[model samples]
Target: MQIDFTPDPRLYPFQSRWFDGSRGRLHYLDEGDGPPILLCHGNPTWSFLYRDIIVALRDRFRCIAPDYLGFGLSERPAGFGYKIDEHAQVVGEFVDHLGLDGYLTMGQDWGGPISMAVAVERAERVRGVVLGNTWFWPADTFSTKAFSRVMSSPPMQYAVLHRNFFVERLIPAGTRDRPSAAVMEHYRAVQPSAEARKGVAEMPKQILAAHPLLARLAREVPAKLGAKPALFVWGMKDFAFRPGPTLPRMRTAFPDHVVVELPDAKHFIQEDAPDRISAAIIERFG
Candidate 1:
């Protein structure tokens, strides 16, 4: 899988692997050799988001992180609907294609719903779960509903597709320890064109459009995965998924759950406190 852009090797030092699954050629990183831990990413980011965690725990854990089609170095096919349910379907296919079993699932932001959708479907194969500032239920709150309406508006949609709003603004806004210029470029370069950013643009719409899917997840996730050992590493300062109702829902869903709150960290906990997240994963599931 040849990407048009080159990531700063210093920041993303891992071999690129390709999975020609049912959808298309998907880009992913498969590192280390142990009990597999599937790392699922959210919007505007890719497998690159999990680089530090992969490097930190590759020695003991098999880290398999894939870029959903239309998001990273993966091939974005024409006419593909970049919906959350579609992404989950593709991820589930990717999981089945790889024949992964007895693995821990880790997700943040949109990654939570996407990967958990996969986990619930393959409940027997999964071991433990790790989640961070993310939600899997319908957007009913005033804040989230307002956010969806604003981001899904025509002007904001244009900004996301044409101006690279998520990578340029949201990414930095959501993180406490800001990413460097070079690191930011890696994000920008992945979706350099408006056509390339269709996936990015669609996600904001999914916040509203994917209500049915999210509602199903809310019911199914707890019912299927409530007993699994879960770790919640929350970024307390995240404006989007703030320390509020979402966390409580997670607690209710996963009874055997440990909460590690990071007061300093923001939304992108993988970026803000990868070391702490890595340490917590090692302590809990290592």
Candidate 2:
């Protein structure tokens, strides 16, 4: 019920900006000046999810991480559509507004689709991609327990956003290493208000709908991306997108891509193993 607007010290000294005035204010941290790197976070997390990577990569590459509408410090409009296509459009507009060209992209969870959409739609700007614990394929069968709940019972929405139980319980459980009290509190601080929760609450339905856009993206992204230097950093221990299930699909899509499996990591690979993940990105892209 309480929201902490305090900015993280680690995220300080970076310029913040907003775009797509009518849609919602997107709070983004932009730093350094070089080939750009856009970092996108998944559900229940925000730009803070990419904090360590931003710090590690900013010195050599221009790093930009935006809190999606209805998450983090971003404004949550009462009736905004949080569907995949809309999120992808916002990403496209944001990149166009910033005039970013020939940059690398890193994505996780929902970010996986959004970033791929951007690359498929705005190919000229994206040079490479770094994927972590996510999927871009269409699936009729739900994969994870959390996803199965969402698909089976509509009431699960209340448990996730309204009650905050899902965020409180699932996030920490999915991590290989329990996050520090401070980090856990930081994650909770951005909890959406009842009205603002609509965006997140609607995610399950949207995902279930398997909007044609996602299917289109799934088919087109691999072809568009080709062998453009991709890095697949996966968490073998992730309960949601288990590597056994998704890795082969990803490998098929990106045959020439480099793959690294972090056996000790979980869904939040960046949080669970920041140093190793950062080192891998720098080694590949720096």
Candidate 3:
């Protein structure tokens, strides 16, 4: 059942639309006109993450950003098994149900892998990819493992389960520009309680646990990733996936693709450099 989405018009102004998805009623923003542009967000975030981008590009493109099964305004049923593969499957179901073939895709954070997974299944359907601060490699690097351990610690779990720190602090911290008070409020308000934040606990842990899945995706996704137009708009200031690891691996993955790094931005480039991102999308895949 849809719950607690008192939309702050200044924040997420778009109308909420739903799809009778494989995982119940999936909520999305279907706006504007022309070729479809699919924006996939990551953990602890929803379609709302792409609100700015949607508003920026909706004039020329049909922007469809969906909240995953247990995210945003979507139904987060108990014991939903929020796995990587399952998330990828629903994306496929979402596009298929809408009969969208030959469209654009943009992914950030966990949205990166999810879009790649969807591309594996629906390559022919995808026109190109807007690769933001995200990667597709297995979580085996020293940097990745270290991030996983820190995130899985007792303090972290307490923050996620009780304090709603992931939504409150981390998302804002990821942005170099620092989102406004209203923006941050809407971010936290979407998942107002502990129960609403269940997916938060499971989502990041997958980065640690999905090595096998990532390995398989590593082997399979590369063959198809470069088949379409790919533009890598990276946030160079990202602490998690900076010069240490994520960016390099992604660089190797899409060697031929265009990469525009934003030194001013952090992990959440969407918040920091939405106009630049939107411009890149228009130039490369518009």
Candidate 4:
């Protein structure tokens, strides 16, 4: 079944904008007005992940949240590469296409690297960045690496496609907020079929594969971002990212960037701590 890409003002509270650019039809929310704040979400989530933050900040800042090509309301056309590098490239194009200047980027999960990559590629356009529960370097522990391998395997494909394991089970497992049934149902609706769910499996596979370009990106993006205003908000309870390692590495990597740790929050920090996240974005960028 084809997923709905329509932007419902009541459901999303913003006009949906689409641009084919060179890649394809990408869905995004452009709300309010001022310096643009580009919000990028991780795997298995979309622009909807930033719903509350957008609602809070739209009055003061122009919020732009895009569903990556494969996820959310974007067109998941055939023959597209959903690897981390491809994602970052698409974001760069998206920014250029819209002519966003001196904007701020806020990304979570896979968004961390993608947004940072764009900042590195086009430093002139990005003024600052807010990274939440995300990683610029690899954060895999022994167990986590083992888990990623299994989840990216063929067996997990069946789980993601046939059973909704990625959204219904795994995502909530990583969060303390325990998203409501209606919210989860909305997530499940986006990738209602196996074909559309192909990206659900591909992203983890890309992470597990750890493409060489990602290693270069990991090494390079941070250096470029260090010169910009950056804020790090960590959900300390995130076992998937492991507070023990990723958080400290983040602080050490950019010693001067502001950091906020929410002990109660988890991997999906937006669900667990949208208010704090919103406040931090405004504090850092507003």
User: Each candidate's TM vs. the true structure?
Assistant: 0.98, 0.92, 0.95, 0.94
Model 3 over residues 1-286: C-alpha lDDT tens digits? 4557677878778998888875677889999998999899987788888888889899899999999887888888766777888888888898888888789888898998888888878877888878787777787668778877887888897888789988878887898867888888777877878787877777778897877778877877667866666788988898767745665666566666888878799888888988988888888877
- Candidate order by lDDT, highest to lowest? 1, 3, 4, 2
- Tens digits of per-residue lDDT for model 4, 125-207: 78887888777766357865777788877778789778878888878887896787767766887877888887777777766
Instruction: Give one digit per residue, the lDDT tens place, for model 1 in 1-286.
Output: 2248767889999998888877677999999989999999998999999999999999999999999999889988876798999999999999998899999999998899999899999999999999999998999799889988999999999999899999999999999978989888889999988888999899988998999989999999999999999999999999989878779999999999999998899998988999999999999999
Off by over 4 Å in 4: 5-11
> Relative to the unseen true structure, what is the C-alpha lDDT of residue 46 in candidate 2, on a scale of 0 to 100?
80
lDDT of each: 0.91, 0.78, 0.82, 0.80
Question: Weakest 10 consecutive residues, lDDT, candidate 2?
Answer: 143-152
RMSD of each: 1.2, 2.4, 1.6, 1.8
Off by over 4 Å in 2: 1-4, 10-15, 142-154
Best by lDDT: 1
lDDT of model number 1: 0.91
User: 49-157, model 2: which lDDT tens digit per residue?
Assistant: 8888777877788989988887777877656778777777787888888888898988988888888888888776778889999877665554543474564375677
Whole-model lDDT, model 4: 0.80
lDDT of 2 at 153: 73
Number of the top TM-score candidate: 1
